[model samples]
Structures are given as structure tokens and as C-alpha cells.
Target: MYQTTSKKTPWIFCKDIINHPQKAMAWVWGYISCKHSMMYTLFVYTLLLILVLLYYVNHRESEPNHDETFKAKVQQSFIKFVEENMPKRDQNKETRAVYSMRTMSSNGSLLEDEHAKILKQRAGDIQREYIGFKNKKPFNFHCDKCAVVASSGQLLHSNSGQEIDNATCVIRMNNAPTIHYEKDVGARTDIRLVCFRSIDFMNKDTLMIGKARFDKMVIWGMENPKHKKIKETFTSKFIRKYPGVDYYSLSNSGEKKATRLYEEYLGMDRLKSNSWLSTGWFTMLFAVNMCDSITVYGLPDGNQCSAGSKKSILYHYYEKRYDECWMYNQHETRMKTGHRYLTEKAVFKQWAQMFNISFKAPAWNLTNVNASEPIKSPFISKMEKIGKKRTKR
Candidate 1:
């Protein structure tokens, strides 16, 4: 009986409410007003959620970054941190990253010597004339005025062609075409940096076409021990065999600071693992080593990936990139594979502060005080003087 009464209590209350007509009318009015207010509040929250969703979806392209100065400052700090510890400064020859020599496993590196040798020997004899990399110290080459040209669509109308040409050496990444893009990217490609994975598909015919142009071809990703076929094929079968082509492989030998920068700043997770750094970063690294006065062209300035009303271009010229660098979530994978370009720029800014480096991006305003040139190397300055005299003569 008690249980039954508990269940009927709500009904008794309703009956009581119904019997008192005036009170019931007042209660109904209060309920109506309260319910209307609650629904209105709920409707406002739903609208806000929709707006947030819209912002999240299109934030990459629609926003225009106005705080380039602040961005530059932040990037400079990254540069300082990376510079204090990078490029692997081991004193022992066997331990350091050998930029001056061919990356053969037989060369007796303390780390990769055994695996590389085994792969090379297993490759056996191939039908090629010039099979070995020139042991003569990175083409016995150095340039005072070098330009590392990135394939950002920002280069499309940058009018940096002349500036690129003016450099003693111009380093380009992948098949960044210069035929039609000569006006924008310049026709002079002194060095072309290709990742080893992409070169495996190229036939002798394709390589022969490029042979007529690019002076020195540097193949990266040779350091990845997983891709043994790329190393074997490049060294043993197809690449070095090409006559008049000086092909060398670059290994991924980074220091702890750089690794931390990738993990902490660039969002790369595994700090100690051997992963493929972007060709752009390594390309810039190579340029800094050889060139006295280095100018980087077409890389996205601080504006591309900035939040809250910032604008950016997807490509340097008209590149067909498989990496979804134009999107936000792609930044998630960048920490793993080293494709987080905007984040990597932090390191580049720090690197520029170390040597004779200058940046030439699309949106560089005259007011940016960080846009100053470093001192030129005496050797490079002399080379530039000689080049100028030759032109005048």
C-alpha cells in the first residue's frame, strides 16, 4: 500500500493543482516562461558550437597572420636553442656525419659502417661506367653566394629569379622545374636535392634529361637503414654511373638539440629514432655549410600557419606534393616525419642567425628588424669580387 501511494503521489499533486484553478493558471504561466527561457539559452549554445565548428574547419586558409614580428621573435628563440646544439659536432671522424665524403657502409663509420657495407657488397656488379662517388671532399666545392630555393607557391610571383641567378650557387629540392618557372625560380640550379625513395622510379632516360642541367645532385634519405634498396640502387646500379654527374648521399645524423627541437617544437614524437627529415631542412643545412652568404627563397614566412585571421599559400610555385602540408591535421604527422614546415622554420631562423643567412619570403615587410644580413665569409667575399670583376671585364 505504501509503495502504491508513493507512485500515486505525483498524480495527487497534479489533481490538487487542477482543483485550484487560479493557482494552476499561475503555475502554468511560470512553467511556460521558465521553459521558454531554458530553450532560448540552449539555442544560443548550439549556435556558438556551430560557429566554432566552422572556424575549426576553414581556419587554415581563411585566417591572415598580422603578427609576423611576434612570430619572428618566437622563431628566433627556436633558432637559438637549435644552434646551441646541432649538425652533430663529434670530434672523431668515424662518429661525425661525413658531409665531405660518399656515404658508403665500407667507409667505416662508427654507427652505420657494417650495415651499409653489407648492402653495397650484396649489390654486386652493375652495368655502369661511373659507379663510385667521388671521394674528393664534396665535389671540392664551396660557394660564397648560395641560395636555397624552396618550392612554395609564394615564389610564383616573387620576382626572385634574378636574385636566385645572382647567387654563386642555387640549391633546389626535387623536380622543382626551371624551364617555364625560370622567371620566378631562376634557370640556374647548381644543386638538386632528391629524396632516395622518389629517384628509384626514374629511368635512365629521365636521368639523362636532367644530366644536361643540374651540376651536382645530392640524394637524401640514404641514411634510413630501412630503405636498403635505395642505397644499393643509387650507389651500385643507376645514379652514380651517369657520366659527368657527381651524385652523393647525405645521411640523417642530427644532434640531441635538433632532436629535441623536432620533438618539443615541431611536434615530432620519437626524439631518438632515425626518421626522414624534410629535404628542405637538409637542403638548407647543406647550403649553410658550403655557402658564405646564403639566402633562402620561397619558404613560408611566419604568416602561413598563424591562427586568427592569417593567410597562406599551399605551394611555392606549382608543386604536386603528397604531403598534406596545406591542412592543419597534417601538422600532427609532421613531428614523426619532419614535414611540419612552419614549425621547422623556427630552426631555420636560428640557423640563419648562426651563419651568413638571409630570408626572402613573400610577406616580408620593411619594418621587420630581424631581416638583417649576417657578415660574409672572407673566402666567399673574395669569390664574389672575382665574379663581379669577370662580369665587368
Candidate 2:
């Protein structure tokens, strides 16, 4: 027996909601008015959804930074701020930046300890010896006067060999030969400064090395992985072959300081200028430090560029190739990857005025240069200050 009740069934309500929206809405409103429980359940669910959305927003806002790019930018900004605001106390870690000439009224010689700092000697390391090989002791030799002979073509037929040989010490650069050119370049070779690349020339036997050729050899190169590996490989082979010849290497730090000198005093950025420093540059520095008086031969001075007489001379005395002035002009004016030969010579000119340095075999006329003028480098000027203070004491 079928019985009819006044309450709407679930099936009828669902059908009405699907087929008739107006009737469904009216029935829903009527049900809500009649039943408070259904209204409360809907309100509770809506409130819970709103709360869940709020919680999600808050959780996202509280999360820590995990972005690598954002972190890198923050780190860079902090480093920049520190560098800009802080005063540097350690010269060893000073910025590798090009500084223009700054005048200071002080004069001083580089102290031995300061020299060691520049060299950046390591613990248990010999100051001067064949590096990477056991030595009896550090190299302990000095000369009151030194003659730094150049490989320039200016020495050709100059007949200055005897005068060069007369010096207390003689320094040669790279793999320059004295076998046949001894009459013009001198026969004595006390020290030979070789860049690592010159090792290839030596291996080719184009440049000679032995106890009979030179008393000691100093190999130096810029600080780089390739240069380092080449230096190590060359050192091993050289020591194995010439066991008796004295050998030493200029430290990476020492090379760095030399590059800095070019930047600070000469206003030439080695990196930016793409300038490969000539062996003459290192030879001059060694002479300044090790010799009381230095006489450089066969090298041009600052005035060579402007002087009309130098155009006919060849680039190398051994070879009759490129013209001296033409080579200098090309290298000096090159947009990239060339030695700053003229610029280096000009700085050498300034050094002549400052130190006990003299030029010969195409002598420099530095009579116009003022000796009392301030040195071009702040580091050098600080050294001068120290010298002044020592004099006062």
C-alpha cells in the first residue's frame, strides 16, 4: 500500500534542482526557513574555506628566500658596499686596480722585509735557489755596479762590449746570444732573466743556457695556471739536464707587484691595455734592487720615439728584420695584444732620474728631467717617505 507524506523526497528535490532552477531556489529558501540546521552547515563550510585561503597566503609570505639569483645579487651588493666603505690595511691583498700618479714629498728605499712581502715568501721556502729542487742555501750575491745589456739592434756595431764587460756584474735578458755577438754585446753573463715562454727558444737551442753561459738564471712569468704548469714542467726538465746551473724564479706575487708598478706609476693598465711587458722591464727592476748603480746598454730611451735618428735601426741586433722605431710605434699604438715598449722606456727614463741609473750605446739625454719632482707611484712615494724618516733618524 503506497502512502503519500507532505515532506519533499531527496529524489524529487534533486530532479527539481536539475530541471527547474526557479522552483529549486524557491524550495531551497522554503527548506532553509523551515530548517536552521541546513543553513548552519553551509555557513560553517564557507567560513572554513575562507580560513584555509588565509592560512595558505600567510604560509607563503613566511617562507625563506630560496632563489639563487636573488641571493647572488644581495651578496654582490654587500661586497661592493664593503669595498667602497672600508680602508685596506694589508697591501698584499690590495685591489688589482690601475691607479694614476699621485705626488708625495717623501723618499725611501724598499726594505728587505718589504721586498720579502712583495715576493710573498712561503714558510720553509728558499728566497733564491732552483725552486722545486733542494738547494744548499739561498743565493747570496751582490754587485756594486751592474750592466744590463739589451737585445736591441742598437748594439749592432756599437763597440760597447768592452765597456759592458768592465762592469762588476753583467745581466742579459731572454735567450740573447753572446757566441758570435760577443764583440758588440759583451762576453760576461752574470745573470740571465728568462720568461717562461723563452724556455721554448732554449729548447730549440736558439738560446743557450749552462754554467759557462751564465752564473745564475731567474725565470719569471705572470700569475696564471698555464704559466705555472709550463714553469713547473720547464723547471723539472731544466734541473734534470743542467744540474750545476743556478736557477731561481720570481714569485707570482713579485710579478703582480711589477704589473702594479706599471699601473700606478706609468698609468698603463696591463690587463686593459693588453700589453705584454718586455723582458727589459723585469731586467730593469732586478737591476734597481740588486745593483748600486745600473748601466743599461742597447736599449732606447723615452726620447727614441720623438728622435728622428732611430728610424733606421733594426728591432733586434741579431736579426736584420723590423725597423726599431716602426716596431716601437706599432707596439705602442696597437689596439690589443702588444708590448708597451715605448711606455716602459719612458718609465725607465723616470727611474733614471730617481735612481742611480744610466743609459748607454745610444745614450739618453735626461738633462731636462727634474730630479726633485715627486715620484709617480703612491706605493713608491710611501717608500720615499720611509727613506726620509730614516734619514732624519
Candidate 3:
């Protein structure tokens, strides 16, 4: 009966509260007010949690945040390797000779001669126009001392990175990688000179690596059928996706001038020869015009072309097995289509004497062109091998 009476008492109280709604509300409100501080804190915490969740979702949708950790790690690993394997060279640093542009003089024999004047007049407009991408204004830049790094196999195991990085500006050629080989080739890439044919390869490297390794890219070559195909496919897509990369191209007039310069240097007609001027040719010209003091690395000097003296090295620093001398010989001997590599080396020797240019990594003796021997023909080499076998017998 006591348990029954207790249950009935609670029910009677609930019935009174249900009948008098104002009293029930007053009781509930009094209880809430007494715990107001705790309730407010819980509400504020919930609101903050919702805001934090929204921020996290927004951040995740954007570019994957390595927060530059990936780039840093890559650099760090390469740096460690360099320190362990090839210590930096701080002694006997190479010095640059003072050079200044000669002004117009009455002698007319120097650079400001009538012919030079005409060429400058033609190039004046194009030189000033930087040609930025994505409707951005082009920035002006200059390098007092520039290092033009080549992709020759001579660079392998050279440990020339420290010296190359000391330059004011470093220019790299098409599709040459400095990531893994940063110890041999400097980690700095101020400008990349790419030909039309190599643009697709460069883009592929960029896409696969998920990073643009160069600051500025200057493309040269005629807008041929192949280039048109690349433009419609890779180039357009690259420009749209990577607006941060500064893209520039040499004008038709500029290319013509460069070709003319090559002709003048080689003392031959390019069309008649049916030969391609090596990229090194254009790269040297660019260095002459853009940089005050130029130092070239990894290009075989004229003396190295001789049969006896030629060091057996790979055609490219990255390529392991291809013989550099053999390839040069094959290309130089091609009757219809080939680069006159030996001839070009002779021309470069002449230019080195004239300009404030110097070569290293099998350095050049600019005084003499006597040692610039032609690469021996592959057939002749084969016949010589056969003769040697007979002699052994």
C-alpha cells in the first residue's frame, strides 16, 4: 500500500503540472536559468566545432597540402648526397674578365658597325617585348654573369655544381633534369631554353613530376606542322593549367636573324648544307646577347674531336651507354641530314676568341683551331678494327 501510495503521489503531482501550464513553465525556466553558464558554454563549443569542420573541408578540396614539405625533402636529400659524395669546391674560383659593350666609333670595325646597327634595329622591338602569359605584364630581367649548362656526358661525375651555382644566373637546356643530378648540375635553374620539338617532352616531364623546375621558359623553332600539333594538344593545355610559368617565344624575324648569324659564323648557307644547327649554337648566341660574362660547361672542345684524344663518354650525361664520339661521328658524316658538330665546334672556338666567353669541363684552347680534327667515319673505324684482328693473327 505504501509503494502504491508513493507512485500515486508522483502521478498526482504530474497531473497538477499538466493542468496548470504556466506553473510548469515557471518551474522548467527556473531550472534552466540556474544552469545558464553551462548551457551557454556547450552552445558556444558546438558552434566552434561546426566552423572548424567547414574550414577543414574547404582546405581539403584545394591543392594537396604537402606545405612545401615534398620540395624541401627532395632538396635536403640531394644536399646530403652532395655533402657526402662530392664536397663543395671553395678554392681557386674562376674569375670573369671585365667586359663592356663598345659604343659606336668612327672605325666602324667594332660591334657598332653599319651591319651591326641594322641588325640591332631589326631586333630592337622584339628584345624589349617580354611576352608574358595569361594577360600578365612581363617582367624585365638581366644576368651579369650567366652559366649555360649543357647536357653533354662530360658533366657526369664532374662535381661542377658548386661552381655553376655561384653564377648570377643559370640557364638550362631542354629536358635536362637537375633533380637527381643536382650535385653534378647545379640546383638553380633561372631560365630554360627549349626547342619546339622538345616542348611536348618538357610538358610531360612537368606533368609527371608535378612541378615546374624552371622559372622562365623560352621556346625557339619554326611553327612547323609538328609544332602545330603540339600547340593544339600539349602547349595550350600547359598554358591554361600552369599560368604561373612565364612563357616566351622568339619571333620569326628573330629566328631568321639567328640563322643568319649562324651562317655568318659558319661561312656556309644552311639551306644548301641541309644541316641542322645544334641547340648549343642558339644557346651561345643567347648567352652573348643576354649575359655580360658567359661560362659554358659540358661541351666538348675542338681538341676533343680528334680520334686519339676523344674521351669515350655518353652522348648525354643522363644516358648510360651511348658513346658521345660515335654519335657525333655518325651525325657529322650523314650526307643529307645531320648536325655539323665538329664544324660548329670550330666556329665556337672562333667566337670564344672574339667574345668574353670561356669554356670548361675539358676546357678550350681558343688560340688554335689546328686540333679540331673531324670525327673518324664509322666505316673506316670498322675496317681498322678488321685490320687490327688480321695483324693480331
Candidate 4:
């Protein structure tokens, strides 16, 4: 039905010979090239838009983010707050806290000379094994903001990576890894407090996750320093396991301090759970001395643990629900086993109110317009009110 000139149309000239192969081939090739050109155009425009968006996000010309601004303002407040509680006259900032003695006021002064001596010797030996051991020196750093990252599962999908990374210093608890979980909890580690229980649980290869990854480590020891030689030997083994990292002996001094403090303040009335403060408690103690405005992420404030949700609740990011959450709750329900967690929660709430310290978890609080502070657990207040009523009666 169609006619073509053989001289002008290349396909027409070859129609009899090749059955219009040239024209058919030309049309197919032309269509493909046109489509490819359209795709290329679209790709170029998309790339340009992406570049503009990146420049806008990465550019620092705009005002600082709200969190950044708030943290900056809190810096002056932090220095002043710490100064009031821990005096420079009594506590030197440069004092090598490894040997720093606590004022036995909170806990009765009770360490015997032999126990104190064993603790000192243990600390010296452990320091000698670390990468860099300084004698009688205070921590050689300061930060405007510090983040104490707790391993509570509430951090699961928090999307707090950017905020956590922004801290001047970040202290992580236990053997919690940030590898796959960096989105919820950022991958910054200024210091990590290693629990004695996790010593065997940690791998030598995992410990080799690069020195550049962190600044230093503080190894928490046994709850009670009463074992003398066993404490020293156990602590020495713990340090020897991680030969390459630079770490401090939070072992004896802290153990001795906790013995007095918890006994006098938290223990005497006496559930066995009353004995040792969790490593998180010790970490907070460290932060109080070093940081200004401490914001703890996931320390289990005892607010959201409902009976219906208890089964699904995870106590730690490192443990499975069946493995840890239930066991932890089960232990709490029994006497003398759990670490006075409810009391600890009460103390933390008081501390948060007294100190400028705040909590961040179940992330919506930050993004929501109405919520400024962490929601207080109604149960905690009710318990306090009942205690007050009993006291009045």
C-alpha cells in the first residue's frame, strides 16, 4: 500500500533484495535511541535536583538546629550545676579518679587497710597493662554535652543517630554494639563502660574493632570488694582479656564507694537486690563529674512497662525478649535478686529533677509539639504519695 523511491529511501532500494530490512531496522533503532535520550534527559534533571537538595541540607548558612542551640545554652548551666555538687576545692578535675576516694558521708567509711591496699595494687596493675597509663592525672578532656547511652531496647528505632553523634562526648554501656543499630543509636563512642559479666561474652576480634573507634574504657568490677585477692585476680583477668585498649580501673575505688553508698542509702532495709548499683548507676556517677548537661538514652525509667506490654518489652538491645526481659522481670518479682530497679528509677527521677539531666527515648517526645520533657511515670508519683501518707500517719 506504500510506495517509496529506491534512490532516496535506502530501505526502498533494498526492498526486493533484503525485504525492507534497512527501514525496519532504522525505525527500531530510532525508537530505542529516542527512548534512551528521554531517559538521559530525565536522569540529568533528577541529578541536578538532587545536587541542589544536598547543597541545601549540607550548607551551614542557616541557623543552627534547635537541639544544637539548646545544648549550647545548657553548657554554662552544666558547669555551674556540677560546681555546686562537686567542689573544685574538694575534687580536683585533674585528680586521677582511679584512686579518688569518696567522702564516706553518703556511705559510712568502712574499707579496712588491707582491702584498700589490695584495691590500690589491683588498680596499679591494671593501669600498667593499658595502652597509656597516666599517674595521678585527671581526665584530660571536657565537653559541653555528654551522652550516656544505655542499652534499653527503647532505642530500637529511635532515629536518634544524628543527635547522639552530635554530643561532645558519648559514653556507652556494657557490650552494646552500634554496628547494625547505628540508626537508632549513633556510632560515636568517647568512652565505654564494660561490665564484668560481659568479659567472657565479648570476642577478641570484636575488641579489635579499632582503637580509633573510642577514646578510653572504664571496666566496672564486682559489686562488693570484700573478696580481697579474688577481686584483684578476677579484675586482672578481665583487663588482660582486652590487652590493646586504653582503660581505667573503675574496679576497687568504685566497688568500695558503692559498698558504702548503697549500703547506707539503698541497702540496709534490705532486699538482696539492694546490694550492687547497676553499671548504669556508676556510669551516671562518672558523667556527673565530667559532663554538664547529661542526657541519658534508654535507662528504663519504669514508666512504660505495662502488664500487657511486658511480654514484648526488651530489657536490653543486646538480648532477645525471651532471653532477658522476662528473666529480668521474674527476678524483680522475687526478693533480693534484682538491683533495686524501682528504687533506682525513683532516684533517677529525683536526679533528673535536681540536676539538669534529661531522658530521651521512645523518640516521639522530641518531634511532638506538645511534649517538652520526658513523660513521668504516674505510678512512681503514686508510690511516692503513698510513702508520704504512711510517713505522715
Candidate 5:
């Protein structure tokens, strides 16, 4: 019999001792595991905090507050301030007056009743050439003294100013608002005929810009705006109210005849004649119809203006370069073809010599005001001598 004492008995089985540990030992292992996990979490949090701090410092350095640098201060105070205070120069006045004078002068006499009635009756005649009226009344027109002025690029800086001004009627196209040394452009023109094809040719304020009382003629080449169906079209809505304004159409026969003459006789490879043909041809036609003799000026001379580094001179319509200038090629081509047509003008001039039709060129020079004998044509020797005497005075 085993006597049981008050002390607790221990079961020391090897398997039980190996498999199970005391409560204190298990608690110690759990505490060590939790401490390791906490250390890892703290390490990750510290790294993230460091990255955020670095980003904040870099961002703060990149952007600065106002009043920081010399570059900004100079841009704000000096450069921009100076630009705001600069003044623009005004346009020259003589140029303005010349154009004003051109538009102001107007003198055109309509065909008298007898002449008009005759022309109307013969409108369908289909004759070889136009025949003059049978009992032709004496026309007040002094066509023998007629002059035509044209602006060419070749005339720029050419100092040919006085010669240009001496003409009876200086005809120019699309006269721009004048500026320094260009006052003669406006002042010398006695008549202004506004030629139009598209509405884009002139602005609504063109009449106001010239500020002169001039006769305005609207030419509707092949493109007639009034016939088109579109509303607000350029031709239909244009308001041309000054006196002496008239609208006329070229007969299909006239156009065909002119085109055939140009291509067959003049050797123009291109089938079409541009604005120059339309206007130049029309001008010639009108002159033939109304005037006994007509003189031409400012037509193309085929000499181009030289480019300068310091100054830019505006050229006459046909004289400007083909690429850079607007509405120029058509005029140039027309001029070349029309020049061929006017070859007969030399013959006409010879005929005028016998009949006493005076043809004169101007004698003024922009470069040399004191220079003598600016007239270049041999046919007008007497006129040149007179011009020289006038210049001397």
C-alpha cells in the first residue's frame, strides 16, 4: 500500500514531456514572435516617412514665392514696361492729298443722242470693224491730248516722279492708301476707274479711304455677281452711288474676237486672258469707241525693282514680282498680250505725227530736282524741249 502524502504527485512520462511544454515556456515564445513582427512594421513605416519628407523638400525648392530672382524682376519692370510706352509714327500727308485729289476730279461725257442712237442701231451690224457715225457731230473730246498713266514696279525709286505727274490723265489700279514720297500717286490721277472681277477686289470702305470725289466704273469681267443666285454675294450687294457710274458687258463676239486675236496673232500659248485682258482690252475698246487718240502710261515695262536691305519701295501693280504680289500675274500676262495689240500704236503715233496729236512724257526726277531733259521719247522732241524750258523756270 502506498501512503499518499499531502504533496502533489508528478507523472514523468518521456513522451508527454517531449510533446507538451510548460505554460511559461509557451508564453515566452509568443512574446518573442510578437516583438519580431512589431520591429518589422516599424522599419517599413520609418522608410515611408523618410520618402515623404524628401518629396516635400524637393517640391518646396522647385517653386519660389514672388520677389525672388533678378530675371523675373527685369522682365516685369523694364522689358514689358518699355514695350507698353512706345509710340507709332503717323502716315505721310502728301500721299493722302494726292489720292484725295485723284478721286475728287471727275470728267466724263456720255455719248450724245445721235451717236447713241446710231450705235444702238448698228449694235447687230456684224461688220468687219466698227464704222463711225454717218453725220458725226464734232466731239468735244481732245483725244489727241489724251494720256494714260500706269504704276510699274520699275518706277519705284526711279526718281521719275515729275514725268509721271505731267500726264493728262494718270490711270492707276487699286490705289493703296498713300504714304511718304507716294503723294504723287494720288495727286496726279485725274480719273479713277475701279475694275472689278470678284468682290474681293475692293473693300466696302475703299471709297471712304480715298476721300476724293472721283468717277468709279465697275467692270464685271466674265464673272457677273448680279446674275448669281447666292444672297449676300459681292456684286449684287455693292453700293456704287457716285455719278457717271455705268455697267456694260462685253459681247460674246467681242470676247471671242479679242481672244482669237491674242492667241493667233500675238502668239499667246495660254487660252485665257486674265483681268488685264478684261480691263486693258476694255479700256482700249472704250477709247476706240469714244476718243480719237489715247496715250498709255504706267503699263508694264518688264523691268523689275531691286530688293534693298534698308528700305522697301512699293511697286506698280504689274511691276511687282509674280509670286510675292497679289493680282499681278493676270495683269502682266494681259499687258504682254495687249502690248502686242498696241504695236499698232506706234503706227498710230506716226499717223498722229502727220495729224498733230501730241504725245508727251513727264520731265520730273525724284533723285535730281535740278536735272534737265527727263523726257526719253524721240517722237516727242518738241514736247521735251518745252518741258525742259518749263523745268528751268
Candidate 6:
């Protein structure tokens, strides 16, 4: 009886609960809470570690190693190649002839009384404009850098006017009429070089070409006597207003001297007889004479429709394309002359590289021909700023 009472006692019951039931439940709850806290801490630590690794990688990539030896070697090699391959200016009789031809072609009748009078007047104006700039202590022409810009019809779409304007002096050639005056021509051009064969070809704002018309209706009213007089009057007023501007006259007479000047000095030759004037010759001659750094934009890459193309008959940009009727005996003429035309444009490119003068074509596609590296213009900086702002948005 005493033993049975001990088993049901309150003390016995308390001991059992402490040893097993309530104690075991408390221990399990404490262990589970600690495990959960440790797991959460580990997860957050791993996430922070991954983020730091990504940041470090990105920062490393952003840095440029300007001191890299490979880059220096490449630049040295390029400079050496250019120095070796380029043609140095020849101080010989051939060079003399080249210069005389270029001067005579651009400035008409070197010994003529009218030519002398015009040159004397222009010389005085040039002196007056440059005198102040030359009198400074350092005697530097401040921003005398000149740029020649050529359009190969490819620049019709690219907005390159702002870049062109950055030049102190800009030279253009032929019938390069820009539809956007303020943005394209007016903004950039400090000087307009026109190769007018006749006074009749001159228009007030642009050089008018008779063959450029697509249809009869386009040039229908241009033939009128009143139109001609109005054009002449407008041109006279425009020139009078801009007296500082110079005008160059080329002969339409198609002489051999002109052809030689076009070929030897200017680096252009006829692909076929009776073809149009070479646009390449015009740009090269002007660049060599007037500008230090030349950037040609719109000139053909020799693959596309150039000034020498057969379709030039429709547009007398230089002159009429050779006519079949003009060739009397095809076999005899062909056999004798062979191909007088320049078949490769690499010759011009070679000359450009040799001079250490930068030549670039911005609108040319690199898919077909080996591409040239474009020199970064000031305009690119402005564009990059715009691009960054856009990316942020």
C-alpha cells in the first residue's frame, strides 16, 4: 500500500516532467530558433559576397592601360611604314610643269592683262586680312588651319555639317549644292571655291548644271533670257557682298595642258576619252594648294557611280560622258590608246598615305573594300555626350 502511494505522489510527478516532457520540448524549440538565425545570416553573407565580386570585375574593366607596350609598338610600326612608302615632293622639271599647269588651270591665262589685274587686287585683300594676325608677338596665324570637305553623295544622309564647321577654312568643289544651307553649307563654309567654265553656268546661290535635270520640265524655264539675266545679276550681287571670297575659273576648252595637270599633279586620269572632268583631280588639287588637313566625305570609293561613270551624261557634274559616236574607228582607237583611264583608286590612296595627311571617308561602307580608320572629329565628343544622356534615361 505504501509503495503504490509513492508512485502517485506530487514529488514523483514533478521529477518526471523535469526529466522528460517539458524539458525536451524547451531544448528542441531553442535549437530550431538558433538554426534559423544562422541560416538567414549565411544567406545574406553569400549575397553580399557575390555583389562585391561583380563590382570589382566591372571596375577592373573600366580602366585603360595606356602604358601597354603592344600599343606603342603598333604605333611605331605604322609611322615607319608611312614614312617609307609615301612619295616625297619632287623638286624637278616634272614637278615644275605640274605646278605651272595647276596654277594656270585654276587661275586662267597666267600672263593675260585681266589675270594680272585680278590677282593684284586679290593679293592686296589677302595681305590686309592676314597682316594683323601675323603682327602678334608670337606671329602665329592663331587658327590658320584649313580643311577641304568632299561629298561623295554618301554624305547626303549623315549630319556632318557641325564637324565641317569646326574647320577655320573649308573648301568644296564642283556642283556640291546642299539643300540644308544653315546646317550644311552656310555653317561650315568660310570660302566657296567654284570651278566655273563659263559665266552662264553660274547661279546666285549655286552652280547650275544643264544636264543634271531629270526631265524636260525641270530645266524648261532656265533657258529663258530673263532667267539668264536674273541669274547673272544675282551672282554679281552675291560676289560683291562677299568681296573677301575668291573665284577660280577653269577652261572648258579641253586642252592637253589641262589633261596633264588633271593627271600628274592632281592624281586623276581619264578612264575613257571625251569623259567628264575628274572630280578627284579637282578635290586633290584644291586640298594640296589651300588646305593642310583634308577630310573627304562624299567622294566615290571607285566602286559606285563616280564622276567618271557612264551615267554622267545625264548630269554634267564634270563634263559629258564619252559618246560612242565620237569614236570613229573603235578597234584602231582602242588598240592605240589602250585604256587611258585610271583603273585603280589605290594610286590616290597611296599618295594620300605617303603625305602623312589624314584621309577619311565617313559614309563609306566597309563590307566590300578594306576600310580606313576614321579620325575622330570634335563633333564626336558632342555626340557621345548626347548618347550618355540617352543611355541614362
Indicate the TM-score of model 1: 0.51
> Which prediction has more favorable lDDT, 1 or 6?
1
Model 5 worst lDDT window (10 residues): 101-110
Tell me the TM-score of each prediction against the true structure: 0.51, 0.61, 0.59, 0.53, 0.37, 0.36
The residue ranges of model 6 lying beyond 4 angstroms of the native Cα positions read 1-144, 179-186, 198-201, 205-244, 248-258, 261-272, 304-347, 359-393
Clashes of 1: 14
Preferred candidate (TM-score higher): 5 or 6: 5
- At residue 83, candidate 4 shows an lDDT of 41
Lowest lDDT block of 10, candidate 3:
95-104
What tens digits encode model 1's per-residue C-alpha lDDT throughout 1-393? 455433323346356555774575464454456555676445445544665676687995576665765544543443443333322323444432332111221234422344323322321111011122675343335788988888777787778888899888888887666777777888787877776766754434443365227777777666567778777776676654565667766544432323333342232233322133576755665565566787888776444444333444555466555322354334423222324454455545645544567778554332322212211222223323433444455
Report the Cα RMSD per candidate: 17.2, 19.5, 23.8, 22.7, 28.0, 26.9
lDDT (Cα atoms) of all candidates against the true structure: 0.52, 0.63, 0.60, 0.54, 0.35, 0.38
C-alpha root-mean-square deviation, candidate 5: 28.0
Residues 278-346, model 4: lDDT tens digits: 777667656655666888887665534534454465677867754344544444343233555554555
| Candidate 4 residue spans exceeding 4 A from truth | 1-141, 222-244, 251-253, 267-274, 306-311, 321-328, 363-393
Tens-place lDDT per residue, model 3, 17-54, is 45774575564454446545675445445544665687
lDDT for model 2, on a 0 to 1 scale?
0.63
Give the CA lDDT, 0 to 100, for residue 252 in model 6. Answer: 26
lDDT tens string, model 6, 86-111? 12223444443344422332333333
Better of 2 and 6 by TM-score: 2
Tell me the tens digit of each residue's lDDT in model 5 across 1-393. Answer: 998665211223223323553543453344445556666445445544665687699988887855556434533343332232211101343322222211111111122243234332332221223221222222122233444444544344544446545655444444432334343343444444334443344443543235433433323233334544321343344434322333233334544554443332222222222113434444443443443445554443221211212333334433344332223322332222222223223222322322323332322122321111111222123222433454456
Cα lDDT of model 1 overall?
A: 0.52
Worst 10 residues of 2 by lDDT: 98-107
